[model samples]
Target: MANIIKKIKRKHKKKKLQAERAKMEQSRQNRTPEDAYQERLSKHRSAVIRRAVMTVVAVAAVATLFFFYMEKRSYHNYKILSASEQEDVVATNYAEMSGKILRYSPDGASLVSDTMDTYWSTLYEMQNPVADVRDDRAVIADQDGTLLEMFDKDGETGSVTTSYNIIKARVSSSGMVAAILDGGDATWINFYGSDGTLIAENQTHLADPGYPLDVAVSDSGDIMMVAYQFVDGSETTSYVAFYNFGDVGQSEDDRIVSGYTYDGVVIPQIMYLDGNRSAAIRDDGFTLYKGSQIPKEVETIKVDKEIVSTFYDDNIIGLVFKNGDKDKPYTMRGYSTDGSLKFEKKFNIPYTTIKASGGNILLYNSSQISVMNSRGVEKYSGTVDGTISDFIKTGWNRYLLVLDNGVDVIKLS
Candidate 1:
């Protein structure tokens, strides 16, 4: 018959392509509740994008393995976890309120606890005592004696008695006072008011706007910074003044708005930088001043050598040099109040006392203790016990060592 009609016309075209692939798999199993919820929301968005790319690559591989194990960890030793109770901190002077422990001397001043307890012990006579805390307020003065005592970690909030003869007194975290009076050849700066009120007075002169040498107050008790030192004819001038008792500097005269002059360097140190800048510390370099109300100057770094030691806090401004490299005999340089440069580091630690606070960099010496952390790493080299005088970080690597045999509270292991 024609070969059986060519095998039934090739089996009727293979049963019409298996009946159109079973009607396209029955229209894909008849799905249509919005296509089975858009195929289960596209397989639940591909399993939540594969668990968010495996949880962002496992939290960036555990933050790059905890930043290379805190940049190659280092902490030699230390473990006095607590030991406050033996008394007699010798010439007693520690300072670091807000983390407790103030302990002054020229007769009295106290605010302790970091295991040492005793949060208030006022009694002043201070012939040469000196302190200046800032954030939780603290100002135990009396350099040449005219009295001053203000505390605030909960106790003794005010007391001042001036009439000239307190060549230095600065406190402002709300217990305002900015004294520097000793008007013998005219040089009174007075600005008190923590309850001995006298808000403003200026009578400086070494032949016009000079001799203030160092005075800084600005923790929002409303601006002030002076660093004079004058002697023009044989050269040796220094300047830096800015006073603004808030009100945008009441029409500008004694509330002087801005200033800057440095014919021969000598800026003795002027600070107020925790953000809205104001620093001056010079003798070759350091001058930042950026407004919160007429601050201006901005930047001035010069330094070449001979810094010896400076250490600050308001978030760093260190500076210590003398590294003729006798095995890294010291060269710590760190800056940030606008002059940039954050770390140079090269320590050997013979430090007599250095501190930078919070970002670390505490090189001590009353029995050695070197730490480093403004990203120069070197977190602790250890050796501590007694005579430490003050290391007070209080938490992280823990420390409150102010000793002469008293409060230990360490933990740098």
Candidate 2:
């Protein structure tokens, strides 16, 4: 009986121990995998939130910068308008020392300005100011007898042989040919490629070699010279001639004024202001020639003092003179297209002729400049500390005022 009892107890104990082992294994498997999966899910969610936050921050920063930048630029342009007293929109520094005011051309380029500034230095000292913007090229005649042609887009596009006797050098309207009159009274016009290749050269004789004061090129690239001659030992005569590059005998109109001058007077300066209009200032008064040779009536403007210069506008001509014997005061008198009296103004300072911009007249009298309306009313006046020499109209609204010391951008406001 005792042996049977021991066997039953041992079997019962083995079954209980097996049941405990199975339960522990099931719990172990469930706990390990569930905890690991939960931890992995938490880590993935944290990484996704981090990426989304960073993206939003970066986008916000870019938007802020862009908005401020645009606002700043808008304020800048508006500031230019608020500073004008007359409420006229004028741009100061329309041209730079090297940059010149040019008529708007969609095809070709030309240097259109009041006078020449030492082109060598002007071409290099361009700033980002609005005044220095131009489309014309610079034709530089250096002291070393180097003729360089620089385009607004291309630097140093062409050059020509420096005139050995270089009395006056001028570029054609197309900016392709350079006509030079040598000191030996020899004149040669050479056409060059934009790459500095010699294309053609035409040598011609001037009407009067003794006094060659002005040279001009028509819009068609025709070269002409205005020379002076002495009829008798006492009086002077003026003559004008033309050369059509190489198309010499194509027409009977090779040279007009091939005759002689009625009055023995020399022309001080000459200019072809536009296609059909021409003007010359002589010792006596200003004269206009219509269509190259047809002489118009001489417009003699009365100057209060010695007449220093006469300039031609599109429809009017102006004569500037010293006001009195003192040579300090000056007056600018305007004339109609038909030599009729337009209007005149007397200034306290000696006046220098400046180009008209935006239908307004700009005059520099010594160290002071006066801006006038088309009717000769003084709109705004400013005092320039330096001696003013030259000025150019950038357009109808702006000008580049140049002095011996520096340049000022004067806008019509």
Candidate 3:
């Protein structure tokens, strides 16, 4: 009976050992090699994804902080000048040569000196008067482009009567005038000397170079640039042609010195920087031309952003575009005649008009005015107390603010 009991105890112990071994094998089988590898890979992938997400968040936070700092800097640099009130100003312009201010209305035009004294006022039969002021002369033409009268600080200089209605007119610094006339079946680009003598005329037809969209004359009245636009089916083409009446263009065909044709461009504004330099502003961008006899293509600037507005004077071309930011509404960019970017700046104000003078730019509306240098640096920002009708630059750092009641000279240094 003792031997049997001992054998039973040994059997029980063996069964217990077997059960333990089976459980260990089952646990090893459940954790397979493929399952272990997959588990390790999932942990590693999760860690990598978490690191990537943290890096992105850090970068975004830095970018947002940088933009906020830049906006604060811009606001801190802005300034406000003194305010004044003015009234009954229809149009205003500044003559840099004589240091005088020109105020015009439908009734007449007046030239005022720096002392606010009216030098002269000339009355004409003007239904809608449009004035263009340069350094030495000012030209007031009817909105219809027909009756054009030139004036100086002294008095009326010359007048030109057009046979066809005038669509647009521009005067050079020396009083040379170029007018685009609306002919019946065609259009005419007429160039006149300072004394209102017809210098040259080019009749543009729809079939040849198309209609003249814009015209510009040289300071000496020796060259004329015309922007001609034509449509062929769904495609639109623009041609900027240089016409020279001087001896340098004698060898060219019909005085057509040089021209550039662009597809899918519509250039509505062209101006001569000087006798040899000219620029044409289009929807896409602007082209700078330089030559003696004819304008040679110097550089072509292509703008990526949508252009909101454009302003040009004798020397600088200014373009205002949306900045794609809510804090800064617009960006003003100035380019030189050689197609070099001179300055770029962002502003919050929505300017109604922009003008580039010698070394400065003037931006104004009915209530606000901003002055900036050629380098896109804001020099001053101020408000006109009363409702502003028109304003003109009296000096490099001065503006004749025309209010609804009177005119105030604002000096911003």
Candidate 4:
């Protein structure tokens, strides 16, 4: 009896499943053409979406692989995009300005584009010409001479005839010119507009506040920094003076906003890192100052090892020291304006110019060039066939190799 009942239950379950299947088939047969088309369209749409997703994933994977390959591959050659006429590197001093090259000589100066078009050019004469650039403005002065010429991105702005010989000269971003002039028993700091008009002049004697070692104007063309060195008693001391030409400094004596004095330490080099920051490069170490209205000392980094070379931009301050390590004898360090160390890289290249730009350290000599990223990873170390006066990074894997022969715009491959 139990076996018969189990067989009956199984037959009922099978009949129910068969009836549901027949009902579903009848529903499909009675359906409208629109319904059937909708069903097919839905399935087709899902299939198309899946294929699109798969293709996107494959393309992304390929792009990632290509990026890694390019990053890791060692570049040994370059492809020149354009070439300029051959200009002797000695006759022309080239400086990068707004993605173009400022080619200047004792005879003249011109700002030329990468496509071999001259933006502007002017003729001048000097026995010894020295150029100092700040932003788009540049001041080219004749050392031990009185001729001072100024330029901008457009063309020649002004020319000044100094009464005293110019020991050193600097230009601000807004086209303010400052010159250290030689006096008979003193030094004169003369400030001038880009229009060749004298704005102000201050004289310093060695027996007084001291001899101005170096002078730098702020990018805003409002502040001036002078590093003065003097001997008092048996110890030699230095003073880092900051003067403001803005309205905030009008009431103060000589427009003095802030100043610092150092005893027994010589600060021969001073510069305005930006509008709000300044640096006084001392013989032993370096000091950074900050402020717009009143300049004050923010940080000082002391160095035990002798600094071999130093370079900086608005964002980074770099120092290269002679390391004690025999294998890697050069230690390159980068710091922010707050005195925080960013990177410490070890290299052995006998570099001529060390430049920090866009978070990469670029070092190059006459033939060899090396590039290291912010993480101290050497991305490129290669050589060019010609004598390189300037190796400028134009873009990713691209450089402007300013050789003695011509300008070779190249891409790393």
Candidate 5:
């Protein structure tokens, strides 16, 4: 009976071990092949996504580096041209008609070529010489208007003697000269042709439109715009009158084609942008006029800031004012002939002289010069060797720099 009991126990133990082995096999078989494949596929996708993300990051880093490299390459400093010299040039002018430069001294005026060669020189007696240079011609006159000399790139064209003492004079591109003369009780505006012939003359009396503050003549010397100021009681009135001297204006009374009156505004400066367009700059703002014979007011722009300086070219007007900032000394605002504000920018450097040429604004002092385009982008800023007294644009990126020592032709690239 003991042997039988021991055999049963052995058999039961073997059966229990076999059942455990079978259960282990079944569990292993229940893990599906598809499930294992899905797990491996998910791991592969994650690896691919990680690699793509890393590639994108690498590309972005490279692109940023390239952008900075290109930006650094684009920026350039000014280069001094091979041509430089020291001269005793008192005044300088560029003639666009003949593509030459004229340097004036106490002795006379010398016309120079682009190669710095003197083409011609003329001697004359000039005291306090004021020169008006245009694309076509140049006119040099003394403060007293005693001697008026008109010349071009070739040589002297004509000379005229003023009847009254000259307050100011301007020359047009067409060689026409306009002079404002002091006539004691009244002011006289005289127009001279390129041949020194008197084209037209007018006198502004105090009893009429008061005193003539400014005068501008057309390129053809056929149209004239005058700004007059008069005080009525406690209020001051300003008038911008257009006079036509052509055949169309001969029938009109006083040859006065049109006139505009402004109360409490002083129009101190008047200019002719072209043969048809005129501008009157007042203490507050400016007014633009358009017409051939009869000028009509088309636009008016009012400025609120304190005007420090103003400049204009044939197509644009620039006003520089203080914006109450310590870092920035002045703000330059540009306007088109149609009264559109084209650009505005702040200048960090102080400038003694400001001018508008072509489509750019130039600001310079004794040691430094800066140029800003029409879009208000600073194209160039650099230190000059000596004190710059005057400068003229000889080429697109070149300038005829007149210094205290002499004149230099420089290139700004």
Candidate 6:
């Protein structure tokens, strides 16, 4: 009985130990499979993540390259040729404090700045101030007298001293300077070159005391002087006398071709009338001179109101006429070369400042500068900082803007 009892106890202990070993083996099997699966899953996930990151980086690099390529293409497309290819640009700077003048080429646009004092041509402390600028020069007057100074990209040539105290100075695009000289026994008029060399001198032996108030020099090198009174003194005739510089101080055969007079009391706005040859404006009436000497062939355009601003190109002459008083609105009219009125439009927004280039027009009210084409289509306008005192066109679509603190040249895309 004791042996049987001991055997049974040993069998029960063996069974218990077998059960414990089986449970430990089962737990180890389960843990080892799970650990292997987890490690494999972690490696797979890392590979997937690395692939995704690389794909994203590659896409971003391609996009960046495409963006730079587009930018470079656009830049090349809108590039403008230098003025030496066609036309030249003349820039002017006024030093308000020192009362001096600075001039430079439009190509070297970076040169005009507060440091202009270091690069100006004539560095004299002016007493009065520069009254007007035209052609490639400025008319500076002081208590001593008035002098016409021509400036290039480098500096100024010697000034052309006029005997007549010029009430108004007008310069042609061809660089001809005309002023209202003193009317007396010794009073006369003359045109000077950019180097202050006398080109042509004209003295009028008028039966009456007649003085030329305004003058126009054409691109073909024809000088037209609009005198208020004629020698006969009957009708208040505006004399259009033409002079030639090719024959300086010569006889009648060497004189310039004199054309017929378009008579009126129209004060010659010399700068606007002279620069463009195909167009002419006399107050409310605008005419297109088609290079024909016949007076009847000239196209005459009549407007209902007085003219405010006039823009002339090779094809058309755009006139801004005041519709009503200053409190009322204004209208702009476009006229053709055949004296035909083409289009008339009204602007509710009065342009406080206006500038024209070729057929492109720019109007600045206060906050924005509106750009418009010759067809009266609004192109694109942009906002400016502070007050824009003045701005001028540089290249085909670039502008040199004068700000309060500094000057910036903006190129639009």
- Number of the top-ranking candidate, with lDDT as the measure: 4
Model 5, runs deviating above 4 Å: 1-76, 82-86, 90-98
Q: After superposition, how far is residue 111 of candidate 1 from its true place, in Å?
A: 4.2
Residue 102 alpha-carbon offset, candidate 1, angstroms: 5.1
The reply for model 4, stretches above 4 Å from the true place, is: 1-74, 357-359, 394-397
- TM-score of every model? 0.32, 0.56, 0.75, 0.80, 0.77, 0.58
- Which candidate number would show the highest TM-score if scored against the true structure? 4
Candidate 6 per-residue lDDT over residues 1-413, each given as its tens digit: 99999999999999999999999888767787778788799999999999999999999999999866643432211222211112122233432111222333322111133323344435444333343444344434332345556554345554676666545555554555655566466446666665667776666555433556556555434544444445344555444444544444145443644444555435344323333244445665664543412112256566667778876544456788777656548687766556567667776555777655535677776556766666555555667765565655654566555555555555666
Model 4 has how many clashing residue pairs? 0
User: For each predicted model, how many residue pairs clash, with residues at least 3 apart or on different chains?
Assistant: 0, 8, 8, 0, 1, 1
Worst 10 residues of 6 by lDDT: 78-87
Give lDDT per model, in order: 0.80, 0.51, 0.77, 0.85, 0.79, 0.53
Task: List where candidate 3 sits over 4 angstroms from the true fold.
Answer: 1-87, 90-98
Better of 3 and 4 by TM-score: 4
List, residue by residue over 369-412, the lDDT tens digit for candidate 1.
87777766887876765577678685567777776767777878
For 114-189, candidate 2 gives per-residue lDDT tens digits of 3432232223221121111212433433322434443443335664555453444444444544434454545554
Between the candidate structures 4 and 5, which one is better when assessed by TM-score?
A: 4
Q: Where's the lowest-lDDT run of ten residues in candidate 2?
A: 74-83
**Candidate 1 colliding pairs, count:** 0
